[model samples]
Target: MSIYSPLPPEMIWEGWEDFKPVWQEIKVNGRILQVEMQGFNQARVVRLLSTDPADYLNSAYQPGCILSFSPQQSTTPGAINDNPPV
Candidate 1:
């Protein structure tokens, strides 16, 4: 019997798209915040990757803001990164 099972949490972002809702990293007032958005929907402000959630909440949200995502070598099945990279 093989003992190499991995369970990862499911990440859900409202209004998800194949490649449109791209992940982004923004610099707000010298702090960095990771975000992902789809259409005109409210952008998802990633918390775990940021220094503080409060900073993101207080910072002005501009959908036109441009950012980049870090590359992940491997991603868990059914996770957000499961889909082909954007």
Candidate 2:
């Protein structure tokens, strides 16, 4: 099996073409990609990739925030490059 089997706990949320939801909340509690999003006002989502969750809580969030993952990105599955050059 692959090193990182299975995927993280996906969070279902929608953004305005850009992923600028509530806030990115991630933790390295387990060696798995886990993302959780809350609904304050409007839809929000989180996509986990690396073993470490991408936390954005209390961080900068606003318009023009490019979403690295989305329908446009669905074409290329497993296309995220979080690893270093070998």
Runs of candidate 2 exceeding 4 Å displacement = 1-19, 32-36, 39-45, 51-86
Alpha-carbon error at 9 in model 1, in Å?
13
lDDT of 1 by residue, 1-86 (tens): 54443643234433355555467664445666567753453445553244555654553443345333454444456555556655
lDDT for each residue of candidate 2 in 1-86, tens digit (9 for 90 to 100): 33453544243223435764355443233322233343333223344444323443312232233323322333344555655445
**Top candidate when judged by lDDT against the true structure:** 1
Clashes of each: 0, 2
What is the Cα-based lDDT of residue 37 in candidate 1?
54
CA-lDDT, candidates in order: 0.50, 0.36
Q: Score residue 43 of candidate 1 by CA lDDT.
A: 49
